[model samples]
Target: MKLLIQNLREYLRADFHPRLYLATAAWLGLLITLNYTFDLEDVYIDSLRGSWKRPVLYILLYTTVYYVAMGLWTYYHHRPDLWRNRRFWLHTGVGWVAYGFYAGFYGYNRWSEQLLDGQIYLFAYYCLSNLHSLVTLVLPLYLYYRFFDNGAEHFYGLKPKRDGLTVYALLLLIMVPLIAFASFQPHFLDFYPTYKDTTANEFLGVPEWVTALVYELCYGWDFVPTELLFRGFMVIGLSRITAVDKNQSGVILPMVVAYASIHFGKPLGETLSSVLGGYLLGVLALSTQSIWGGLLIHLSIAWLMDGAAFVQQWAQQPAGLTP
Candidate 1:
């Protein structure tokens, strides 16, 4: 514990920029306030999926504004060289394109037909459909990394350290109750577990429990791509292009804000909380140089919360009944 504290102190001393930190806080606070005031999440989701035209326009405008701001940020740090750097442009292109493809996958799934019939087939389809992060995000980012850095091991926080794992595991243990406590809230139950259809009796003659187990595993696996993209690619990969000093946390700000923005579709409290959580995880990934810890905490919290919800629902059922 002392070592963990000491490491965190060192991280703070090296990576925490007071002004940038304040800027991130203020920016996220304002965005959250406006989000609740205007209910912009609904608008944002509608704009993204309902129509092809709105989605395209939103992507174009959002990406343009994002890159322009990023260019200005790079300039502010006196790293104008990044603007002309082929590697940086390539990274930027791949990142946005991957995100677009991921979104497209979800949108397609939403609009597509239920052609597959059996419960097992449908369940598998649902799980495999989440591969947008793997297929589009991780793969392309890795290829890009290999192309540029000659297959560096630490490209996206893949190389884990013993001390880092210990610290993050302890941190994950500490978050157990926080997740449980959050599960009691009505709002939390509504969104958590993210898997709604647990009432299926069987799939391919397999029992419902077996199918549920498979579903939960896949559900947990879904977060792998999330960790890869936000913590691994965004924090680790993009940090090279944006940070003036690779040792500092300046590059983490953009990723943090963007991460928070993605949570806009969630409940207000969770959305607001994601800003701090996202930033901390990003910093942890940066400090430890591994997403394994982030993945552990993320997957644990997610699965536990889902379990809590399932238990609560079960308890509410009649004595002889089953979900």
Candidate 2:
């Protein structure tokens, strides 16, 4: 952890620009404010649900928002070469497309599929929702790695690293209390323990824990592709196009802004926290040249949040509160 902190401090000392950082913060704040005030993301996505046009529209929306932030970074950093760089285009293009499919991939009415009614329907809904990242982000990006980016970047940081893992474990431990505190907030409780409102265990003739385990596992697994894409591809993979040393490379901010845009539809506090979280993870992933540590920490906090929500609900059961 000390090493990580030193690396981050050094990197910031070398790269930090007060005006640029503040401008990027304002840009991100404006985007978030506009989206929330107008309900733009929800309105756009919900209206296009179930249509092939959904992802298409999302590509344009995400790309515009992302690049404008990147363009802002470029203007202040004065990286005129970035406009001429082919890999920048490649990273932005492929990334926006992958993100488009993933974010636009809400569950839809089955046009020809078998109808799964009752608790089974809700179970299937959560199951597919959590695991869609495998199809939308992981598979496409892996293909990009195998073909276009073969032998570069440890396959977008998919390879594991054992060093400094103890720090990641300690970070996860620290998040437990924070997550527990969040579980008490009305807004946080509303969206957490996402496996609620279902009794599909009886439908499957198994204990409730069975379905809960499956949902939680899939929920946690979604972060695998998420970390792989944002920190791995956007930060690490995108860095491959540059000639600067990793510490001096100008990648984390753009990725941080782009990553935060995806959280526009989430709770306001959650969306806001994503900026800080994404920036820290981007720095750590670049410093380590591996997404494993960030992935471990990201996935652990997520599971801990759900676990806190679950324990809170259980504790309330004896207080005359209903599940």
| Poorest 10 consecutive residues by lDDT, candidate 1 | 104-113
Cα-lDDT of candidate 2:
0.80
Per-model lDDT: 0.66, 0.80
TM, every model: 0.82, 0.92
Model 2, position 280: C-alpha lDDT score? 77
- For 1-323, candidate 1 gives per-residue lDDT tens digits of 56556655765666655665665566667776877778765666455554565445435533553464454345445567767878666766666666655654444354233544444445655666664456656777777777875534676887765547776778778878877788789998778666656344443666766767777787787788778777887777767655655555345666666676667668887776776678678777776768888888888877888888888888779889867
Which stretches of candidate 2 lie above 4 Å from their native place?
106-119, 151-153, 318-323
Per-residue C-alpha lDDT of model 2 across residues 247-308, encoded as one tens digit per residue: 66678887787788887777788888788788877887887778999888888888888888
Candidate 1 similarity to native, TM-score = 0.82
Residue 243: error of model 1 in Å?
Answer: 4.6
